[model samples]
Target: MASTHSTFKNALIAILATFPSILFYISFLHHHNNEDHSLWNWCNQHPFLLANVMFFLNVNVLFWFIALLQSSLHWMIGLYWMVIPVMLLHFYANHPMAQYNQLRSWIVTILTWIWSIRMLHSYLRRENWQLGVKQDWRYIDMSHQYGKNWWWISFFAIYISQQVLQMGICLPLHVVHSVDKPLNLLDFIATVICIAGVTIAFYADTQLRIFISKNQKLKQLGQPLVPILDKGLWCYSRHPNYFGEQMWWWGLALFGWNLGHSYIFIGAVLNSMCLGYVTMLVEENMVRENYRANAYNLYQKNTSMWIPWLIKSTSNDKGKKN
Candidate 1:
């Protein structure tokens, strides 16, 4: 049928569009590999590098296939989580002979895996996949906004572009894997910061989950609706979880910084910027639109957006002052 043909054509175009990003990622890997030894040149010297490249290609190809089959932007967005696992596999398979840094690499790899898995779990739960619910509100909005062109646009815009951004944001992992030095005091400090950030994020999410559950229960009981969370971590910052995420990335950057790789910090910087844009622009706007706009606006005015600091104008502070 003509419809089938059109679908096939669009799929082909999407696949073709991914090539430039693929080539760019390869070139980026080569450039970074050249910091010590050229990745492209060393591909001939070490067969493992070729295997690594192949693994990367296969994983992405699988992602593309899944995206096409599902036609769901949720899957496309979820592909970002794949970066952590792929990087971990690459680190383990291509581990250098330098035994000193092996422990450090293992630590970072494990932490990355943990963070990725936790985030994937959270996303799935929030989306409620078991009941066949799919796609978050943002993706739904995007679908409506883009109309029929959403399919191909999602391929090029969300899927491929996100992969590239994830690669860049994972620069710290690459740096950690490549560096030959042993874990030093700086690494220890960075590890502490990373642990702290993860802990904060975990607890922040837990608090939010509990709050939501309680609010839902109240609603079911026909009680008045509570539109916003203002206790626990939410009291200090409107986006405690986002702050924790930024802290975690910065901690990873600090690990690379300890290795004296200034460029690797770009990942943390980019991650922070992305979070800021999403939290301040996308998420806040959505909250105002969907929830109590005046209350959210007041919260935004009083609370730090991305840092856990006292909001002096909060009810508790006002009560104490009075």
Candidate 2:
């Protein structure tokens, strides 16, 4: 059928376009290394490991593309959840440094895996995966915006772009795993910060989940939805979850910093900037559109946007005095 042929043609185009990007990324990784041994040379010596990593990337991309075709962009979240573990495992298997300090390596690997698992669990619970929910609101918004063209657009914009970002963001894992340095004072500080960030995010997400559940129950009983949460961590920062996320990366960057790998800090910088842009522009705009705009605007006036400690005077209170 003509339709079947057309679908195959689109898929082929996507695959072809993605191949060059993957190759470029591999080259980038190789060239970015400051070590004497090139990644290409290392790969040549470890052909099996190279093959496995390539297969993993290809399979992940193809899976995401298929999910896009099904109008299920939620799977992109899964791709992100898998990145840390996959990259960490790749380094563990191939890099000699991973075996240098078994305790330190285990500590890093276990912590990352725990965080990844927690994130995936939160996403699944929020999305109600058991009930077969297939997409998040952001992706749904994009689908509405793009209409018929969303299939390819989502593939490139959401899936492929995220894959690239994951590579950059997970750079710390690669560096840390491949370094023979023992855990130092900076590593301890980094660990404390990372753990604190994860704890904060965990609690913040719990509060959010509870709020959503209560709102859902109220709606079921024909009551109004609560527009804003201004208590607990929400009282300190408008986006504690996002702030925690940034802290987590910065902490990881500190680990690399302690190791004297300056370039590895790029992951934290880029991740923070990306989060800033998303939170300020995309997420806030969405909240203004979907929720009670006045309440959210008021919350924005009083609460710190990124820093939890810097609370401001509310516009409402100022107006009341006037």
Score candidate 1 by TM-score against the native.
0.75
TM-score for all models, in order of appearance? 0.75, 0.75
Against the unseen true structure, what C-alpha lDDT does each candidate score? 0.64, 0.64
User: For each candidate, C-alpha RMSD in Å?
Assistant: 7.8, 8.1
- Stretches of candidate 1 exceeding 4 Å from the true structure: 1-61, 76-100, 129-132, 286-291, 316-322
Write candidate 1's Cα lDDT for 151-206 as tens digits. 76766666555555666666676677656787789888888888878778887888
On residues 121-228, what C-alpha lDDT tens digit does candidate 2 reach at each position?
677678653312345556778888999988777767675666556666666666665567777778788888888888888888889899889989998999877777
lDDT of 2 at 280: 68
Clashing residue pairs found in predicted model 2: none
Clash tally, candidates in order = 0, 0
